[model samples]
Target: MEAGPRVLIVEDDARLAAMLRELLQSEGYEVSLAPDGQRGLHLGLTESFDVAVLDRGLPVIDGLDLLTKLRERGVLVPVLVLSALGNAADRVEGLDRGAEDYLAKPFDIDELLARLRVLRRRPASTVPVIRFAGGTLDAANRVVTRDDGGRLALSERETALLERLARRPNQVFSREDLLENVFADADDPGIVDTYVHHLRRKLGRELIETVRGIGYRMGAAP
Candidate 1:
């Protein structure tokens, strides 16, 4: 099995920082959090990471300055800049400063993960393959194959959802948790149920165990 990619996230907002940490950790990435740009700069310069996620506004040292200093020190790991400054010029500036990608605040978690995946340039071999009672989920190709060899192609959303569940078999995920990590607030909470149903229809009704009044997990009925 491939090791989890290491990630450094620098954001001053306590709530947002914690949320980002939890979400990334759930995806099996080894994550470290820095609440200020100074600490972030220190980590970026001293330690090695597959990628870094940074916020534009930071205390002690501005995020842009941190990025600038990191580059000045020859740190070349990909950086995904996250900020509330969503203007075109703002994005251009971040890119100019050497961010590999830029994401606006109030962003969807799914998009963030997708961007990080791209930035990491994860090799095909490192993609996780998940196996359960009835089938295998080939994440590299986003296909789920049953023991009999039948395969079900999945949409990106479905693939991410399945991947998360497969990573921790039997671990339940609540609707709110799924909504926060798998979709944006623009998406209705009911969408979680919709996708769960779709997975059931394709993977078998019993493949995903639903916890009444709680959430869903990976498994089958007895």
Candidate 2:
């Protein structure tokens, strides 16, 4: 990738979230920290973190619930569940929900970064770079640069949500699809609406059409 991979660390334990943030940043990643799942969900949906390190035990919502929600929403970003629930059954369930990898507590920072590297290294198919409603969305780069020449400021999550919907512009995607497309941590269903609102603000309300009873879709196919 041409730019640094972005990551979000959602851990209720304040101490740990700080450590992980520093560790990942030192390794050249743009890292965001959320102390609990509630706020984490906000950050996850609004920003595009390449991968997420989620703690299973969280206040507001548990880790498993977060993971399931992410998959249900259609956030295609890879997830690596970071939890102390290392039992065979628990680990199995995490992977089944949507985790690309699982790391138990008391893990080595180096090991976690190594796994993150693997997740980041995986390739995504190249689709024609999409242009619509005045902005150029680089599907492969997962970055959107508006025509105004403003800095490309999309967080990893914002980029994911836009790319998913814009790529299939005319097709509608329900809240579930957006969840899986952006929030890889299984946070909450309501969070889907929040992300859409944020995405709409950035892309311009006219570009993404809202289907009252269904979900949302881009104005027209690119």
Candidate 3:
């Protein structure tokens, strides 16, 4: 018999993960489990899957951060974000960060399965590409390709920072905000400045505009 559609579950709770794995397997899904965000990210980046189920609060890397990293690295796998943070803002944030669907904790298993079915059915061609004035960030591969066809590969942190700024062109993000959202594990806020400088040097100084007292925003693409 043909194998079922592959599904990856990145949940930290051992009992919950096991239960989910068994249930999904029984329902004819080929499930893979990751106990923490780090492992989840490794699997997410290196493996192929029809869909993914991710928990919000994870160790090593936060769920949203893992989602963001996956996106920045050009992983187009449809992700369903499962989190206890079901508030309006949280849902919006999850969607913005790359989740195809968001379901709150204590959710119905049937509903979750239904949602997964929906996500699995989504066309891979529907994945959007991130573009700028001078080039496009290839979503299939983690590289910025210029109009002239020159490609520049960015480090994971650089890609994450650039992706965040590029996604919201008009908004200015303060250093503190970037530090909190993008560099969650880092204690020194100056790390933000350091990466910004690295991006500027690699992509071009015009790639990121530093607001005098505010912070930084996406500048003219180069």
lDDT by candidate, in order shown: 0.82, 0.75, 0.86
**Number of the predicted model whose TM-score against the real structure is largest:** 3
Q: Model 2, 97-180: lDDT tens per residue?
A: 878899988898889989999998877424466776667887556667777875465665666677677767778888986665
Best by lDDT: 3
Better-scoring candidate (lDDT), 1 or 3:
3
Question: Would you list the clashing residue pairs of candidate 3?
Answer: none
The residue-level lDDT of candidate 2 at 178 comes to 69
Give candidate 2 misplaced runs (Cα > 4 Å).
1-3, 125-222
**How do the residues 1-222 of candidate 1 rate in per-residue lDDT, one tens digit apiece?**
988999999999999999999999999999999999878876875688999999989998788888876664445788999999989999999999988799998899999999999988843223556887788887657798888888889975677678777778869999887765554322578899898888888888887888998999988521
In the order shown, the candidates' Cα RMSDs to the true structure are 16.0, 8.0, 5.3
lDDT of candidate 3 over 1-222, digit per residue (tens) = 999999999999999999999999999999999999988887886689999999999998889999987775567899999989999999999999989999999899999999999998888844356787678775445578888888899876777787778778889999997886666557899999999999888888998898999999988866
Point out the higher-scoring one by TM-score: 1 or 2: 2
Over the full model, what C-alpha lDDT does candidate 3 score relative to the true structure?
Answer: 0.86
The TM-scores of all predictions, comma-separated, are: 0.54, 0.57, 0.63
- TM-score (C-alpha, index-matched) for candidate 2: 0.57
